[model samples]
Target: MRILYGVQATGNGHITRARVLLPALRAAGVEVDMLFSGRQPDRLFNMEPFGDYRTCRGFTFVTDAGRVRRLGTLKQSRPLQFFRDYRCLDLNGYDLVLSDFEPVTAWAARRQQVPSLGIAHQYAFYHRIPGTGSAPLLKWSLQLFAPVDEAVGVHWHHFNAPVLPPLVAPSPYPLTEEEGKILIYLPFESMDEIRYLLRAFPEYRFRIYCNIPAPETQGHLEFEPFSREGFQQDLCSCAGVIANAGFGLCSEAIQAGKKLLVKPLQSQIEQRSNAVVLEQMGLGRVMPSLETEAVEDWLALGSGTPSPWPDVATALATWISTGRQVPIQVLTRELWRAESGNMLSLC
Candidate 1:
């Protein structure tokens, strides 16, 4: 079967997910082609998994110091170019189209009358999941941005919905936790600001990765560029993780049993919702902004227990191979039972 998978490049989560899912699909004996959008093609790294992928100038949100800059995003969107790209896109030969919240292929499939499936965390919002910060505008954007048919949502938990577990990168480095070692990945925040906020915590060592042009370090805080190998190594070594409330990183941290603290992007519904669910499940802590108080409070608390999650990538591939629809309840129950009994749902 031929598949055209669309991934959003605005954040690393979709890219990270593709890194695992693509290989699983290939192993299932399915031919897959990936179309990535949002960031420039040159900016992407560790792309060997996609294997001769295609890129397009896709729409992306602009952010400034942990908050979405609406005006800047509006100014940056090339609507005419987007319309042209939409019209020019061809999904004629593909048997199925799958999107990870990518607008290009989703819209293309909608217009061309091709079968489309959305497989991403964002789609979880379609159901009554744990969520907060609901604005009609952002809600509308989420719906219209990536329109699809018969969607499948992935989350840290099923939330008694059709949602499956998050698909994460396999542990590349063995878990050798270093006490007081923290991995900070707040890409949307200012470097100087993150540094300033973290300076007070001199007792702890931080390995921070952002969009730095080069690698550098300051005192106890180490700054590095986007390196998948280096990040995984540090993630494996660190005792905990401090990052933006992105599902990708938080999911990885949870799966690895690392203590997690997240600062959700301002005015972002998905992020706020993620934070709410995480906190609700007692899996992690959330800070409203880059405020030091929340950090102080979080640091005072002990690390939460890590919950074992199923290998969702392989399961998804197997499910896709079988045409019959299996309920997520059945899928999660069997997979979780097979993987580990120490579930956070135990609480």
Candidate 2:
């Protein structure tokens, strides 16, 4: 079957999830075309696998100083371009359309009368999951942002709903027992602020990854350019992670059984809700701001038991190959069993 896969490039989490899904689809003998939206063409990384994917300025939120700036995001959005992209996309040749909360492809599929499947963490909001800041506006945005025919939601836990576990990168690095250093990846925050926070903890080593070019080393603090291989290496060795409460990294940390200290992006309802659920599940600690007290408290708390990772990508590929007409509950149950080791007590 010929499939059109759309991925949101607003954050690394969506791209990370797509990275795993792409190979799974190909292995299943499905012909796939990729479309990426949200970020600028130049900012995308590790993108050679998509096979000449299309890009556009569909939609993305602007962030500053570790916060999602509401006003700035409104100012930066280009509605005309978004509409044009949506109207211009051609879905005639593909047998199926799939989206990871990407607006352009979803909208175009809707307009063209194509059956679209949405696989994303955002879809989990439709179920009764642990969430905070569930305002009317947030609910409306979630529904309208990426409308699709079938929705498959991914989460850290089942929450007694049709939710699957997180799709994590293959376990390439050996699990180590070192617990002195922490891996930090807060892309939205300014580098200066991160340095200031880590500088206070002179005893703990911090390996920070950012978009900046120049690398710096001072005392126990180290700044390095972003490299997927290098980041995964540090992640394997570190005892814990300090990052925004984005779904991707938090899921990866949980899979690795690393201690987590998450500071959700301010003014983002989804992130706030994710933080709440993380705390409720005993998976991690959340801070309202990037305060030193929170970080110190988290560092002292130490790591939690590792949650079983799911092979959702393979399951998804099977479902897609079979034409996505299966009962959503059955598919979710299969994935849940794989994720929770058939231990219904975890749910």
Q: Give the whole-model CA lDDT for all candidates, comma-separated.
A: 0.84, 0.84
lDDT of 2: 0.84
TM-scores of the candidates are 0.94, 0.95
lDDT of 1 by residue, 27-58 (tens): 99889999999999989998886788999998
Please provide, for model 2 over 1-347, each residue's C-alpha lDDT reduced to its tens digit, 9 standing for 90 to 100: 99999999999899989989999999999999999999999888778888789998989999999888888988999999999999999898888789999999999999999989999999887777666435756546776999998888888777888887788866669866465788899888887888778877888889888886778788888888877778788877789999999999888888777888998988877888899988887788998877898888888885665654777888889889988778878888877766556322354
Model 2: colliding residue pairs: none
Q: After superposing candidate 2, which stretches have Cα over 4 Å from the reference?
A: 342-345
